[model samples]
Target: MRGPLVVLLCCMVALGACRREAPQTGPVDPSGDGQVTISGDDLVIADLNWTPPPVRIEEGAEGDARARAAEALGDDDLHATPASAIPLYLALSAISGEERAAAAGLRRARIRLLALGTMALDEADTGDSIAGLRAAHEFAAVARFLAADDPDVLTYLQRVDESDRLWELNRAAERALDAGELGEDGGGALAGFRQAAALRPGQPRAMQGLAAVESALIRRAEVAGSEGDFQTAARWLAHAAEVRPGMQTVVDARQRIQRMRATRIQRLRDEGVAALPKINGVAQARQRLAEILTIAEPGDPVARDLRQRIDRAVHYGDFRPGQVFTDALEGGARGPQMVVLPHGGFMMGALPGDADAEDNERPRHAVRFERGFAMGVREITVGEFRRFVETTGYQSRAVRRGFSMAYDERTGNFLRRSNVDWRSDYAGAPAADTLPVLHVSARDAQAYADWLSAQSGRRYRLPSEAEFEYAFRNGTSERYPWGEGTPPQGSGNMTGALDRSPSGRRWGNAFAGYGDGHWGPAPVGSFRPNPWGVHDLEGNVSEWMGDCWHATYRRAPADGSAWINPGCRDQVIRGGSWASSPAQTRASWRALAQVDTTNARIGFRVVRDL
Candidate 1:
């Protein structure tokens, strides 16, 4: 009756006639759904080109099927009835094989799925949503198979998938919000709404949820402000403003928090000032200043002045024990920062039964340090020393003398090479910027300290011999800082397994079975720190102390002061250099160097009074 029906009927007739033709001479190919044949001595193709007519129910019967499907879905009550009615419609589809059958099947599946999804969303039940979505998908797949290119079927299936996803995200978001896991740090209802909005743009419910979250954050800010946590309150209001700008509540909260913050800062400032006068020592004063810094706004003059007074107290060793500082030098250069050693008493010389202990370290006597002082965390580095030279045009003793004690790896001996200075590589090898600055004399080190003191407006000098020994011992009576062990793994950088290279070959001796993975002086802090949090205190280089060289401690000061002699020619050098043997690197080992002498194996670190 229609154009498509007429074409289908004609094609069926033509295919039926073609099916009667017999094969002429070749075997038949029956590997497909259609059949092959030979027609009157000519080749005939398969019958696949013909279209089959669709089975259909009578009009009254179709009306009955549709009504039954609707009743089974229970659309009026939004509840699913027994699925026994599904098979009835499926049997009808098998008999009819019609496009309308497929459409009916899709409609029934969509209705049940939508109803179930509605229930899940309204009740906020995730399990029911999943079950309904899976059932709908099965029906949708069958409908697609029946009418693979049906536009209405494709559209309805898309809607079903979107509904499933929207409800799932909504449920999750609601749960997070209920658990109080949302807002500024981000784990709540706000995140869920954003996901939903991304899925279905312009969604009214998602937008409403976002607005609710913003309002809640604003309220939290008000509560925090009332509790005197003005900083936290401001942070919350800022998060709200970010969500929705130009809110009157946020503007009002900002003003209120600012007023509260100023009053609170002033009260804290006064409290800190009153606490300062009551602080009897450097330790108490430092504690009070640290508290003031916590609440004080940046660049507040009261906080700044309080910090200055605290620094003065530390300078005279009036501050607390265990304080550390970063004393900036000229050109804003900083090295490894300093740490304050606790004021206490310990044996100042070598321990008993130390075979490596020299005569100079004998007659061990008790040394008491009443005032705590700060020491460098690491040795002075090349970069830090270079900054001083570049800023002040200052020359080191090695540079002025045009030569220093350098090692000749080729000959395996120490030699005074011409034109050799601090910049020269260890025995003519290139050195990194982080290695300790070597070839510096005692006077040259003092000059660096003077430069630092001028730049920082504070006192900086080398630690005295007693201070060096006390800090090295770190409250231990053992031979070494880490107890009695043969230079265990990761100890201070010394001549080790890796020292068989160019300059290392020249090193007289090295620790057997110990490898620090470096040939010469490694970078400052390259090895592990000592017990006192100080790095390379025993090995990188023999550090020069403020005290002059003394063969023995017969008349040494017991007050932890430098034992300087006006006419002394050599300065006390502690902490054996990299070129020294393991025995020479012992804690009790000591050496001496001319005050104006420079050597690649010698350098120094500074200490500030605290």
Candidate 2:
């Protein structure tokens, strides 16, 4: 080290002319010796021994030297170089007065040497020993040239020692392997890992290297088995087996691989079947149906029928297709329908304090619809209604009368109004074609129903209040079609205050505060559909029922059918309109309007026999 230090000092003095001005005072004295000494212009080489020589730069060679240094630093793959190359370059640069070049060379050389040394220790390969020794000598020489105060030089010296220690560990691992203390797979992997660990033992990656080697060997064996090289595969497997004895999982895996090679398809099929749970009867049928549906072509009759059967079963609480009921109703918007109601009976009526609950909804009578029926899934869309009107020249009550009831906030009531028609109101709106016809009166709904019946040659009409309720209730006798709770906002575009209002006289002001105080009707079904798949059952508009609005339930029919009153002029509207409040939307809630009365908030979904 002292010999290298003297050499470095000589080089620094020789390269003094090309050396840049030192950024700080003479070398820092960590020993606090209070001695001021100078070896060359702005260069103080101190404390020789283990230290290496400084990188030197001769006059006029500064530019070329810096360029060479940059080039060396840029070689990312220099790790393949022998570590000795790094220190050798540093010593040469010092002698040649090319300090910058020497620094770059040394940096690359050190990194590569460290990597090599670490790898050598891990693999226990003596191939890197010569290079490692050379790199150590070179580093020591450069350390001597660096100012005694330069922490960088001291750090490099410490790194050299650490590299040596790793090398020693690698040597010990090699010795162990040679002594038969470790098997080929395990010993070889361990030797490599131990070397990496010695260099950076605290890093988890050091252990990962060992694992990676094991994985590679395993994969090679698997590949051999896949290629029909059974013997080679067995040999690889045997190596692994020797390394990890008593590992039943590995043994089983090897056996399985052999079996797969013997009977690939059968083995796969057996495994697949074994993985499936034992299913029976209805479950098996359901599973088959699901599989068929997944791969079935769209519009396939069989698939469609199967899907409908499934829906019917789910609705009626019966897995048997024949068990579900079906009746014919002239197709309204949706073609040919069936009525399917839940089997259970429900206590239909106003609870303790239902605001809009009338005497008719009292006694909370137990009423039941024996079967679930599939009614028209959707209300007649504008396009369908338009076709009916065009084909029959049937003028809707709203259009014929040229006016409809709209809630007027200023008047605190619904008033006769005209500016908007269904076509105009929903013009340019997306999905308008599928939206239920709005701004139609009870008369219009009836006419459309009549027209549909006539065209289809089947009976079609507004559902009786009971039928409507049954359909709306779906199966659950909850407050709403969905369940027994207030629906979230936007479930339907009804007046917010109406939905928020409690049932009673206090709630009567809903019409006045319609639109949540904004006052206007929103498009039909601009909210969540009921569980039964019916939309706008409540909120968007009050739907006209076939029955007349009665003052009480004195003689109301228990059957799920309409109780029509021939003498009545005012048609009954169930399911409160957008202008009405939540109380008005209750199952027992009712409203009355002249048969010819048309309103923006009044629209209806038709019912058919099925």
Quick one: best lDDT, which candidate? 1
Q: Cα miss at 194, model 2 (Å)? A: 83
Predicted structure 1, TM vs. truth: 0.49
lDDT of 1 by residue, 1-610 (tens): 3332222222222223333222121221223111112223331121212122333446557657556655654532211222323433554555554447645764665455344334433322222223333334434544454454667556655665675676556556545654655556776667886887788775554554555556567667767766666667878888888765676757876787766666665665556556655646445655655655665567877668767666544443444455566866556666449887777788788778888778999788878876678889888988888888888999888888788878776777778977876676567454567888888888899998988888887789998988888888887777767676557888877777555764445244667666666666888888877667778877878898999888888878888889988988888888867777877777777888788888778888999865
Clash tally for model 2: 46
Question: What is the alpha-carbon lDDT for the whole of candidate 2?
Answer: 0.53
Which pairs clash (backbone N, Cα, C closer than 3 Å) in model 1?
Answer: 282-318, 282-319, 282-320, 283-319, 283-320, 317-610
Candidate 2: tens digits of C-alpha lDDT, residues 1-610: 2333222222222333332232211322333221222222221122235423244556675565555544544442221222224433654565555566567676665555344334423322232232333334343444444333456556655665555555445444433433433334455535655565666654333333333333444555677766656567777667656533566635775876666455432333333333333443335445545554443335645545545454544444332312223233344334423334444566656666665566766666666665454455445567767877777888776666666555454445556666545553322122365556667777778888887777766567887777777766666656655444555555665555443422221244443333432233354445566665566676656788898877766667776667787777987788866566667776667777888776556667777553
- Per-residue lDDT value at 372 in model 1: 74
Q: Which candidate is the best by TM-score?
A: 1
RMSD of each candidate relative to the true structure: 24.7, 23.2
Q: Count the backbone clashes (under 3 Å) in each candidate.
A: 6, 46
